[model samples]
Target: MSKLVNKSQCVVICCFPANYTVGLTTVVEALALGIPLICTKNVQMPMDIDHEHCGITVEPGDMGGWEKAVNYIAENPDVASDMGRRGRELAEKVYNLDNCAKDVSAVLKTLIKK
Candidate 1:
């Protein structure tokens, strides 16, 4: 899954009707790989996908919106590439393991101090 996702141009996470917190790992992988995404809005991290223009989000169960978003990305290669670059930047700055560890350490230290 990781190799396939890393090699893909874009990833579509269609977690509709059953919103589990499953697709976030895929999302992070896609971000790290600089791939654009099309995802259901009910996923655990819609803000991360939408805020950075890393992808398009459609309401869960909205097939038409999904199709439109896919088509838009397909038709706009430049925009898609830019989104991918932004996603990579976001992944490095926010989602990298080093940053995550730092964040955790900070919280733990604060808790210990308190």
Candidate 2:
């Protein structure tokens, strides 16, 4: 999976625009492997895929939007590569396992204290 993701130009996540699954680990996994992304709106968050330049987001059923996004990546290979690099950096520096573990531990400690 890592190899495939890294080799790919981009990853496309097809989900309902309103389906709020932003915290899905798959997004992190893809980013960690340095793959650019194109996903439905609301599929990812915290990292702000679009704003962070890690990916593009489109409305759920918007085929035209999908085409434009795909074309953008295809037409601009350098930009796509940059997006992947940014995604990898974001994953490593912010969404790494160590950070997640620490966050979970903090919450657990708080619950225990309560």
Candidate 3:
């Protein structure tokens, strides 16, 4: 899946059971690879995509909305590319391991000081 995702133009993450939140790893990988995404709204990282304008989100179980989002991306290559770029930027800013570790270390230090 990693290899395939790396080479893909876009990724679609469909969460099952309508309300379950999953697929964070796939979302991270897609963002790291600068691939635009079409994702179900119930997934764990919908806000990451929405706030960053990194992808299109559809309500879970809404097949029509999903299809429409996919078609919109397919027809608008430049828009899709921009979304991919934004996704990569968001990933670097928010999900980078070094930055995350630094944030955790800061919190721990504050707690220890108190």
Query: Judged by TM-score relative to the true structure, which candidate is superior, 1 or 3?
Result: 1
Candidate 2 lDDT over 8-104, as tens digits, reads 8888887765545753677788788888899878833566688888989888799999999999999999999999999999999998989999999
Clashes of each: 0, 0, 0
Superposed on all Cα atoms, model 2 deviates from the true structure by an RMSD in Å of 2.1
Candidate 3 residue-wise lDDT at 90 = 84
> Could you tell me the TM-score of candidate 1?
0.78
Those runs of model 2 whose alpha carbons end farther than 4 Å from true positions after fitting are none
Off by over 4 Å in 1: 1-4, 17-20, 103-114
Best-matching candidate per TM-score: 2
Query: lDDT per model, in order?
Result: 0.84, 0.84, 0.83
Return the clash pairs for model 2, or none.
Answer: none
What RMSD does each model have against the real structure?
3.1, 2.1, 3.5
lDDT for 107 (candidate 2): 98
Per-residue alpha-carbon lDDT of candidate 3 for residues 1-114, written as tens digits (9 for 90 to 100): 678767776899888744435877788878889999998776445455766889988887898998899999999989999999999898898878997789889999999999
lDDT of 1: 0.84
Q: Write the per-residue lDDT of candidate 1 for residues 80-110, one digit (tens) a residue.
A: 9999999999999889999879988999999
